[model samples]
Target: MATITSAAPAATSDDRFFMRMAIVIAFTIVAGFALNFAMGRSTIAARPLVHVHGLVFMGWVILFLTQVRLATGGSLAQHRRLGRIAAGWVCVLVVMGLAITVDVTMRGGTPFFFLPQHFLIANPMTMLCFVALTTAAIRMRRRSDWHKRLNLCATISIIGPGVGRLLPLPLMVPYSFDIVIFVSLLFPAAGMIHDWRQSGQVHRAWVWGALAIFLIVPTSQIIARSPVGDMIYAAVTQGHPGEKVPGLEFPPSPMPE
Candidate 1:
């Protein structure tokens, strides 16, 4: 009698895809924490609200890492179980994010190394975009492809803070406003690269989203300096104790032409 042979079960493609995603997520988390540490040290004397924002943002990073780990480790049921908690956590994150933006602007705490006039507008717009993308991602959670893409977009949206911190602020001061566009574009670039490597095609939505974010920086600056934005800023700051208006200055008594 001939001996019977047993074949090993082959791993599914989903397993390989999940493994790759896990690696990328892990790398991003490590990079984020390192950047945070470096920037936090430089801004050690920053206001309490800055620290609060950092803590909340770091909590989000931790949660993201945990979720990725859980999903990749064959804990889908437990991951779904924690989805509700994550949703509530995201709400708190949005609240803290908005509160930090308001407090920073009101207290004249926008990073001084950059052009405050543009930074003020860009920062808040970033927060708003982050919230919008994140909410949309959550809404499409049941649709795996849509959910994944939206979640990646949301991740890119929030990355400005991390990227801004990691960049050499002093070196970029001359083109501070433009740096926002550069940083925002990086996320979509990363996504495009990932998609190209994984599926041999770049997703159209991500391409569009990246382009939108790149445009938003300049557009937001234009709007912020416009009459309407000026009026809104003035109204919002009217009741605040120590608000400051940001603008460029010209020296008095110019040399004769």
Candidate 2:
């Protein structure tokens, strides 16, 4: 009988890469909270929607870290199994994100750093895009290259919120969308670099995915100004009768002396 040949050992260098990525993620979260505290942003006061959004987002961060740990531990089978749960969790996150975005915008209590007009329009769109990209990534899981790139794209698309907190709001306010564009570009750039190093050619999926996300800012802005956005804003705001639409006015402190 012919001798059977064993496959060569796969590269296991993802440990260092994942550890570095985890550090960056942890730093972003810490810096986000620190900046919010320093700026006295009112998100900490915690409306119901805000609480739910926070919990969902924090859970995502935890889940991401856990996934990285499991993958690095060579628990590929377990990681794939847990990914189903993570996929469900992502849907919940998107729902809570939309709920919070609508709740804050309608109440006219949008985050202080963001332009209320832009925030009202852009936030929900961001969440929707995130869900779409994440779902696409899940769908392509059997294709490792596609799965990795799409997941990176999804993560990069959502990094704006955390990056925004790191920026000085006063400086960023006039160029909020520009900041988002710049930060959002990093994912594709990273992908290009990875491709150049690994395969000597940039992946078309990363190129297209990044471009799509880049276009969304202007698209969302136009949509926000359109009658459709106005009508949706009106409908949600109408739920609270007699209170002025908050986006039309400056935010008020919810606490009283």
Candidate 3:
């Protein structure tokens, strides 16, 4: 009876914490994109592929919020069913993410603040991080503590694009990628703090997840500046407008109207 009583509250507290975190993340993504659209940074005139990518990403956010609700609401049976679907969704998400990265870079549409090489490398690396963490979450689903925390981290990993949109990337210039990464880490950092406060120790899953995000930024930059990065960028942009755009150099700021 004592164990049951104590465990009940801890579990309830965790559910509430995760639920809140999910809502915040969802809001961040939606607000970032909506703000971009409002500012004319995004457009309805974008190619069909871009539109499909947007829809796919928005679908994942909705699905993520739904999963959190089901789990916190004690609908584990339904949550697991959705979990199976989410596993497949991650694959589609990754494909679309990589596809859009290549599509934009080929069109010379890579963000002005990012080196084309860095944008190409970083986006895919971020997706890979999400895939690895999410795979771990699914495999350890029976360990609810590890499972939920890993899922949160996985979602947090990919929010850099959304976070980037919320910031003044033009003003950020050389350090925009680094600043976006630092802001994104705040989500998982909050998770770590919450875990510490609740249990007197931070969970190892949070540590690993945060570390993955931390390492990927520098690692991607290093590769983007290396010979291998040159070869990959050259191959991808062969005979295209992007080839004339220096892979390692940031594109010039557009002239104000």
Candidate 2 backbone overlaps, count? 1
Residue-wise C-alpha lDDT for candidate 3, range 43-116, written one tens digit per residue:
99988999999999999999999999998885889999988889899999999999999988888878888999
Residues 1-257 of candidate 2: C-alpha lDDT, one tens digit per residue = 22222211222433545445655765676678667778787456766667777778888877777776676665889889989899999889888877877676667666555556567678777877788788888888887667756776776677777777776655465566667667768757765776676557888778867976887788787876778767766777776631374443334434453
RMSD of 3: 1.3
List TM-scores for all candidates, in order: 0.75, 0.82, 0.97
- Candidate with the larger TM-score of 1 and 3: 3
Candidate 2 regions off by >4 Å? 1-19, 42-45, 239-257
Order of candidate numbers by lDDT, starting with the best: 3, 2, 1
- The order by descending TM-score is 3, 2, 1
Error of 2 at 84 (Å): 1.1
**TM-score of decoy 3:** 0.97
lDDT of each: 0.62, 0.69, 0.90
Residue by residue across 1-257, what tens digits does model 1's lDDT show? Answer: 22222211112343445456545644555575577666565466867877787787877777766765676565878877877787787777888887876665566555655544455566667766766666776787786555656655665666666565556655565565577457657666876776687668887767756765676676777877788667655654555642454533111222243
